[model samples]
Target: MSPTPIAWQAETVPVAGIALHLARAGAGAPVLVLHHDIGRPEPSPFDDALARSFSVLAPSHPGYDKSPRPDWMRSVRDVAVVYQWLLGERELTRDLTLVGLGFGGWIAAEMATMAPRAFKRLVLVGAMGIKPERGEIADQALLSYIDYVRRGFADQRAFDRLFGAEPTTAQLEQWDLNREMTFRIAWKPYMYGATLPHLLGGVATPALVVWGREDRIVPLECGERYAKSLPRARLAIVEGAGHFVDMEKPDELAQLVIRFVNEA
Candidate 1:
């Protein structure tokens, strides 16, 4: 397959009394992508695939990266609400698709529960929100920022591909900013949402819950619970992949998402 030349260009978009650093590309129906705790400062292969079929909107969540954080915003739900306004302003609710990964997945899930029928389809990849019935979600606060990131990949080579064995000082600093923001918003509850599962019951959006088979951070049980809670949801486990599927198996993961989003 020929590589796509599509690339994201960051721009400042003012919405809901905040200026968001948004990266946009592609053309077609809208797909709003929510980044993880570390933020997707660069485009993922998954996003590139989606751009072939949809207009992609990837904005830095408030307080992460270039996006300014307000003192008032303190929860994942708050971030979800901000994106809702961004969708409203852009008139993207017409035929929208929502995709969130890890922390961003938590935000996407919150938004889906909040406005159940707003999106055409929902995709949550190795999302962190609900507490697992069996095992505990890995504590990001306890580990070094790099260690936390390393824990997401299935193996060392995958980790090195995204963030090399010896990441530059700039890369480390970026992760530092992201970690602080995550600590600020998700500290009290860690990563899981206490009432998120209960709230998901009424969400009518068709959700595709994708989890890496080798994910060791967020337990697989959380994905199972999410699939069980939503009115219309199914779970897909990608073999040999870890929590960071975008890094470990971007093309394969993208295909799964594309097929799900295109489903009738």
Candidate 2:
């Protein structure tokens, strides 16, 4: 017998004056997903897989897609605070599992540090919040669109999703807007907070750092650093994947998350 395919329920909710475009589904426990820089408000394959076990709420960050970016949202920490307000407003502070990917992981780290007691568990996939002491994070800003796409996935054929079909004008505009917001929040510190590692040490929430073994953006070492820094954190390296581990290995990542959350 085959399994049922999970579908997402979309919504536009106002949180602290911000109208957040959210995609959600499933019923058991709450899992909030903070997305990467180029992601949209709609549900991806990863979201569907996650919904099989736990209710998943994935929000497009402000200035991405239909979500509005406030003038004051200049840093990852600012978004973290807004999300804190979001969880409280939705009354989803208890028994929650928080997942962040790439750029989103940076925001999630900030949120966990700000309110360590709010969530039951945390998952960071190809996350970037701390500056690497040895290797450098890939400079996405400098790379051409094709090059960036090529480096994102372990399988280079995935680049076709971006370049194979010509993008519509609207898609191009949204890409520009998302990039602008990324620069605004991360440009100064360049994708990492100077004190983030120190703050992570104080986080008591159990966290799982999932990284792609061949990640070209944020190195695997960053995942190791995160696991070592957080009070109760561990690392899980998924093979044959790159920076977009969730996209490349959605089912595997989902199983890993399900196992972790179930154990808690």
Candidate 3:
């Protein structure tokens, strides 16, 4: 297979007096994508698909990847505020879309709650923020990087296709960085907020809460919780996917977002 072409223009924009490294691509309205615990690499098929219809902007949350995490940044809420500031800096107070994946979902939920009307549409895919009534959220700290990522896909081949059967040294190092950041912000409570569920009510933006039927990471019940709490949200499922729906089924996920956000 040939090497994937560049999909985004790398840029560093300052928000709230701090610099944010982000990838910007395509054209049209903005779709602010908040990534999961693991920082996503560029040239994603899902992002590219979105780029075809709207501008795709993905930022490395502070303390992850190349971004400089400030000492004041302690919780997911802090990250959310930075993103909200990014929108304000760009004059995207409203008339914009927000998509969050896994851990990013926690950040997105907080942002939407802080200013519900700021986003016109919201999509949370296999998000982790609320505690489940039945099962527990998977504890990634207890597993190796490979083991943790393996749980995200229903199909092992999909994992091999994306991260290789054996990840490289550089990849492993990046995984460590991701783990460190995840621990910094999402620890103690272990990938959840006690008040997130209670605060989700009355959001003005329409939301699409998607989950993988086979997800062993964050249980499907959490998705239901998100749907139930958000006044204008619907729950959707990808049959064979796990927590990493975008990695396992990018096109399907993209299609879901497009259809939901396009609806009158």
Q: Superposing all C-alpha atoms, what RMSD in Å does each candidate have to the true structure?
A: 1.3, 1.9, 1.7
Candidate 2 vs candidate 3, TM-score winner: 3
Error of 2 at 64 (Å): 1.2
Clashes of each: 0, 0, 0
- What TM-score does prediction 2 earn? 0.94
Stretches of candidate 2 exceeding 4 Å from the true structure: 1-4, 41-43, 161-169
Global CA lDDT computed for model 2 = 0.85
lDDT of 3 by residue, 108-208 (tens): 99999999887889999989999988999999889999999999899999989988899898988898988898888889899999999888996888999
Per-prediction TM-score: 0.96, 0.94, 0.96
- Top-lDDT candidate index: 3
Of the candidates numbered 2 and 3, which has the greater lDDT value? 3
1-264: candidate 1 lDDT, tens digit per residue: 779578787899897677999988899878888888887846477788788888888889998888987767788888888888888888888689899998899999999988999889999998999987788889977888788888898887978877789878988888888888888889878898899988998898899999999888898888998889988999999999888887788888778877888777
lDDT of 3 at 123: 95
lDDT of each: 0.86, 0.85, 0.88
Q: List the residue pairs that clash in candidate 1.
A: none
Please identify model 3 stretches exceeding 4 Å from their true place.
1-6
Clashing pairs in 2: none
